[model samples]
Target: MPAFVLLIAALALAFLLSRLLRLLAQFRRIQRIPVSTVALLPGSGQAAVTGNASGAQLSSPFAAIPCVFWSIEVQEYRSNGRSGSWRTVLARTSDAPLVLDDGTGRVQIEPAGAALFLQDRFAAQQGMFGGLNQSTLDALERLGVRTRTWLSTSRRLRIRERQIRHGERVFALGEIARAGAQAALASTPDAPLLLSNRDAPALARDLTMRMLGLLALPLLLLLAALLIGVFG
Candidate 1:
């Protein structure tokens, strides 16, 4: 029942509560704004749109798979004698401009700083005896990442690639603006664009689950502190 322990737990709880409140507000705001079609998009203001993305095909960094949008995350496992943990070595995302077609009309999307919620398209792990494919090796080389130490076999590593296939259905949230004669989605400093394969309802459900999971630890800590403070 140390006062410092109680104080630390209380602070952690307060910080997490603030984050939860912010996320809740965001969820409410998104819920209030109805999803719009490209043809019906407002001349100016925030809007959510769903469409099939069209763009020049690009090769994924790790898998070399064709996609319109791609991201790769590379992590290496390190052992601390008795325990092991994975540390990220490289991460990259594509910043390409694409068009979203909803059958009614098309809108341009610049995805540089957008938040992406994409599912993994390719995943692989390599251990001491395992070897990475030539394409992946070439990709790692291009990124200037060496898998092995100076003299030893490559360290245990995992690589995951996420992508949006050309013409894939997508969900987008951002400000709607006119790009010359065409309508487009643009991100502002206050509201960065959000892109996802999942629809709004699905994204909200995922966010709720995340908030619930985040709630558990802080709540448990606060409860423990309270009980200890009362009975210790």
Candidate 2:
């Protein structure tokens, strides 16, 4: 076996192993923590909670669409007249805190670093000369662009964003506990966060499936490398 070939395979194996380990660790953590209601939890500890999004309605940066949490991605089509691909021009996520109401009480979620998996999403594309709807044109303005100048460029722009709407049930994992009489619940500063539109059980299953796929990569690569060395 060529030393360099073996080295490359080893590096890939290391990366795959790291990812696999991380997935397993995360899964275990999620498993050990039971879901708690906002009204019932220790004063401060890592926990899982299920609730509805409430509090102030979030305004999306690009379209000003109402939501609790949102992610926006804008892409511009680039072409050489013979070949083209959509290129991302702007992407951002909302940092606004949202209230999670579990019927028992409300928990304020600071979603600064939380991973979100929302299914209520939107995506669209528009081009020059009134080729798009009026709403899309108005949305482009909120995203910081002049409608006339944008369409005059003769380039197609794609807008994509997803939101967790108010009154929607969602799962949230973080360090949360009672915050005295003044506040119902609050997330600790150093807690691991996992917020999603899927319920706790379904989200756990999805994570495990993804983890297994990542775990398979290293083994497959190792087997392929061994076969090549033997046959070559």
Candidate 3:
């Protein structure tokens, strides 16, 4: 019975440790972003449609919007003698069809999606899990949220760039075009990217929290085992 208890405790400890590590990582990631920005991303379809309605309608008639789609693009720079070519990253279903420039024969990506994709692509490419310890990996596995792949693929573009103007801050068209090519790919279906203009930080935070929960499994089990020991 004591041996059995130890086995149970070990399993529990493994689970909890995994959860805690995942949450901590997520928290640290979220803390890096500005909260105000996440607020600006579009909400649920119903909320988006009714945002301009009467004040009474705006109170609490609808469910909160959950993240649906989020993507990032990145550019890679390589040298081919004196000339260079730019490739689009983060292709999605929603993005405009790519067209070859007649004069330059270069591929062009819509600016907005391109920028967002690049930020995420760069982040992923840099290896977010480079220094993660074994405990963290165990936690991620427990949560079933491991990074499967992050490569570029030839697919329809899903994110389109939209220009936003705010006073003197002018994002030039050519400026955004500099980010090389989008190469980082994401996991699908079970791990669909959560999209929200302002919620990246929140999403990162939630991921961290969820990881922590997984890590705590061991502690919870240990408590249960202690109780069983006293009772048995």
Candidate 4:
């Protein structure tokens, strides 16, 4: 309502706009690359490969489920009565090469530094009323992360796990790297790899929806600013 409030809002919107524009640019770049199978992959260039994930699986730390890739995050809710926020206590990810088979061929791809888009396999919260299962609690304790504390009433623990399971369809985008007789899809400085469980079309749709949502907020803010300037 005040001039200072408007100024702060304007600055915030500008910052958000910069981030959104960068994401939009990345979305365009990904959309332009055509999806290719492992067999039809070219000798050299950027590539988008679709195939089924296969290989030795990692045991998820929190859930202990078998997966080609797994990521677990634990956050603790901290509050000062007036405000509250979730603070990450621990985060872990499995970094292993997995085999991708597109029926025509198979390629080994590394998972490090790749942007993963997979559905969460498990998500739950732990509080005074309820807590994570005993096995999970034991695992966390082994990791030296104490889920229970003297101030448990004022704090809550939350955990979530995401995984890429074996035999699941996966989409990978990056440049091709050759090692002797084998070729692998990998990330470059300019073109980082992206791995997702969704197909190309579905992934594109999701990106489009996110971009639209980002654009909508800025437009609404601009319109509101205009109305305030005219009638204030």
Q: Using lDDT, give the best candidate's number.
A: 1
lDDT, residue 224, candidate 3: 85
Cα lDDT for residue 81, candidate 1: 94
TM-score of 4: 0.83
- Please name the candidate that would achieve the greatest TM-score relative to the true structure: 4
Query: Candidate 4 at residue 154, lDDT?
Result: 31
Scored against the true structure, residue 174 in model 3 reaches a CA lDDT of 17
Q: Which one wins by lDDT: 3 or 4?
A: 4
Q: What would the per-residue lDDT of candidate 1 be over residues 25-94, giving only the tens digit for each residue?
A: 5577468788887878877988998999888889888777888888889999989999988999998888
- Mark the regions of model 2 whose C-alpha exceeds 4 Å error after superposition: 1-8, 61-64, 73-91, 123-160, 177-191, 230-232
Total clashing pairs for each candidate: 0, 0, 40, 0
lDDT of 3 by residue, 44-145 (tens): 110100011001111110111121222323333333899754455433323322222212122222323332311221122223223334443343335343
Provide the clash count, candidate 1.
Answer: 0
**Residue pairs in clash, model 1:** none
lDDT of 4 at 78: 87
lDDT of 4: 0.82
| Candidate 4 per-residue lDDT over residues 9-70, each given as its tens digit | 88988887886876676677678989887788999888888899987768888878888888
Please estimate how well model 2 matches the true structure, expressed as its whole-model Cα lDDT: 0.73
